[model samples]
Target: MELNRTTCYIASLRSSSVSRGYRRIIKGFTAYADVCFREFGNHVKFWTTINEANVFTIGGYNDGTSPPGRCSNCSSGNSSTETYIVGHNLLLAHASVSRLYQQKYKDKQGGSVGFSLYAFEFIPQTSSSKDDEIAIQRAKDFFYSWILGPLTFGDYPDEMKRAVGSRLPIFSKEESEQVKGSSDFIGIMHYFPALVENIKLKPSLSRNTDFYSDMGVSLTYLGNFSGFGYDVFPWAMESVLEYIKQTYGNPPVYILENGTPMKPDLELQQKDTRRIEYLQAYIGAVLKAVRNGSDTRGYFV
Candidate 1:
């Protein structure tokens, strides 16, 4: 609690929390940011406010797989509401922290604060099916636009609002203004791609549908994704960069994390030609995107 925020300071602090056993994000994150900047901003050049924000929220709040693990099927959770609420708080916290750095620390520290999300190159299940083609956009709305829409345009994707309905949180005018241009860069974490299939889920009488259900798309990954290494599809990286370029006005981007996982065998680890090829292919993809006019500033492996 102490590490998270200044919960102790606000004696009257009360959260209108919709998620079970979780208070709405209040002061802990920005307070922690302030401390980190005061102590380390002089040396740090890039500060990413959150890492893999979307995936983290969905895993923890909707899938019951991470910290504060809670979901509809768990002992206590409302996957329908908590995922959206938690994701909203993450955006709010990033905005607050970014604003703080810009106002109080930027002039003196010469540092940048950025926002991050895990990105997948979403493809249609069938190349010829119009429904599958459209489903790719729907998947992007939930996976990409859920974070970038507000950062770039000050609102959630219209599709998301229509689908999630009242469960999706709304940013007030002030929040919209604050979150719109809060980041110095858009950080992307990429490794693989997903094939998106449109699903017509029958209307549930109960209000317990999770984020995936709300998005109305199913994502299936290709390859042996159980840490044996990732399948290389460099074109997907180029496609992602292209989408961001056309959709979000070519914001400055950084590939914060991108790497293939390998099995834990010492012999294979030592003879790691696969990882080399992965890096080479992805780097080539980034170079291709750059040639095609993506404002991608950096990449990390």
Candidate 2:
């Protein structure tokens, strides 16, 4: 698919309603996928239904940090529900495209359709405290399980359903069946890890409270969040892979994005010593993870 075009269409769909505009998104993507399959399926064995699906939803709808930005306090969009609504629609769209490929192209092309998301390693802010550890789990549920749980188990995580309450969309019987096992694999973009601190929900928080508020945890980004010349914790890569393997039934995995950015410098660009070391450590971690029986199939910088 032409990523730039599809992305613009998708990034704008959150403001749409399921009755009309949302279905258009589903049809639009299916139409695009059909074309891509016909044109590129023979050579492209692996197809990602969406790039960084989780981040796409969060950055656009909840945080208003990216294209078609929308948030609780933004000029439009309800951060509390739009994110989930858009995420739900994305899953449906993916499932539709996956079904289309499986029925029409998979046999001849021998290709696969997969979903991708952005992931970051999370550790307890207070290493010795169980609450912080539990907070980490909650954070994963809100982030990873929110998308993966449906793709794997045909439903959102129990924690998300409970936390988001009626704001979360429900999957119909057919939709649930379509969503479960639709992906042949999982793709992830992993960069840095974060220290997660447990937080209490404020009494004044409303139904329109944002996802971060609903998540009930705060992240202290390591390396000050820019990820340039910071500490390299390769073990976190292994940790992330292990968690996905264990939590999500060890599906075939690919590291679609992994690398640190560096400031502009001619010598630095030529040598790239820091990036070389960063990738070496992370790729080594992936190697160790594969050695330890992770179903990880590929890694990319």
Candidate 3:
């Protein structure tokens, strides 16, 4: 189906008045999810409420790289604040829908609901400095814990709370109760690992920071080449799984997207040797994590 300009504009959810619009967006999303559950609950046993929720907020609100494309310098948007606000609303919407299904349809449908997050295995650039090591943990908190913390522990990580301060939205007692432990499983989309370097933010910039700025670290992507390329690093997948297992109580996980991208060459596509090797190695990494009791349930390419 094609979306007209008006529909696309409204669906963008990009408004001059963000706070009020955020509430309406959440309400609309939850109502839509309720309809889908009532219509498809019997046929679909596993429902992923939102795919890459973290990336959607970050890319759309902070970086201006996705739909509705708003950023600090864009025609509209507060990169630092809007990203957090959008993320907060997305979580509330997901939890509300999950609760609706659990209360009304779960017993009869016997279905499970979860949400996906974009994950990266972060490694310190230099092992010599304690600062880099600390930065690594902080990056993880900003990237993974921003969402997982609420799902697993009922709130955002303390580091994030302290970093974002008032810009970050607060959850009430009842909202917290509903958000905590809302998902039956957590879906992860991991492509590569990043070498994290410690970076000190200027005091002025610190006063007005975006998500990456608040992270207080620089990420260098490494693989077959610099920048973006066909880089296959299976060990990164193993590290990510292990981190989730050791830190997040090893919840049920599905490798929702773990594949190597290739150019659209008919001959190369027909052969597809690199793709096969990538899958084999990554699947092996998943097996290692599962054998080590990581509670990983499935892998999808």
Candidate 4:
């Protein structure tokens, strides 16, 4: 079971009562995880240490839209650097907790530990343009690899290192050893796909850049920016599963969150035909991915 919602770091960073740096945060979070493991490990066979690590770092540090509200122009926080710093600390913290579980509790408890990331199926805005196609991959590198790369391969993606330069955190030999192969499974929280359009790097790079600016791509959602409406696109789910299978050695995956939000209409909420159809289509897509050997193990909404 997933214990933390937006991750311990995000919550702690948001809390006005708590003010700590990355190292302190990691130490505190690892201790907290130890307590949870000691208390819940016997009954819970599957544990997710953090939820949406990528989104938390991005929304909180990069955009300053979430808790702590720190950005380049905000009252505090460095959008360009803090995101990577927090992300690096999270990877190390998650690895430490997973190692604790494996060494101390796995055999006795018969439980597994995993990490979760916010995932989006990105489609190129212009299918014919080679740059657009490449931008789609760059976006993935910035978004998915920002977290998954360290967990899977012990370092951030080469593309990310090149793009973010010194802003991206570095992993030492020991930290890399601890971070790699840290998870038994990966949890994905996907909603809808985003159309990725290639952008010129010179303009964004000439000025101060955040995560999206580093990726050199713009994400356009099909519907409103507000969370009130959604358009079901099951193909995006299938594509994301397939991409993960091909890119990440087909690790076990759990669909931790997938759903649509509707407005506060009592009659429509009672009926909810659209939501039902959305679920059915997405489940079908998951089945299709499994049939194609995606190694998807669980689904949650």
Best by lDDT: 2
Candidate 2 global TM-score: 0.91
Clashing residue pairs in candidate 1, if any? 4-28, 5-28
Off by over 4 Å in 3: 1-21, 204-208, 224-229
lDDT of 2 by residue, 1-301 (tens): 4221122133544355432226677888799789988977776778888888888888888888886777877887788888888888889999999999999999997877889998889999998988999999999999899999999999998888888899889999999999999989898888789999998866785345778878888999787455446677899889999999999999999888887766788998778788788888998999999998899998987
Per-prediction TM-score: 0.89, 0.91, 0.90, 0.91
Candidate 4 regions exceeding 4 Å error are: 1-10, 14-21, 203-205, 224-227, 264-270
Output the worst ten-in-a-row residue range by lDDT, candidate 3.
2-11
Q: How accurate locally, in lDDT, is each candidate?
A: 0.81, 0.84, 0.81, 0.82
Clashes of 1: 2
Candidate 4: clashing pairs of residues: none
Better of 1 and 4 by lDDT: 4
Clashing pairs in 2: none
> Which candidate model has the greater TM-score, 2 or 3?
2
Candidate 4 lDDT score at position 126:
88
Error of 4 at 32 (Å): 0.5
Compute the lDDT for candidate 4.
Answer: 0.82
C-alpha lDDT of candidate 2 relative to the true structure: 0.84
Worst ten in a row by lDDT for model 4: 2-11
- Clash count of each predicted structure: 2, 0, 0, 0
- All predictions: root-mean-square deviation over Cα? 5.2, 3.2, 4.6, 2.9
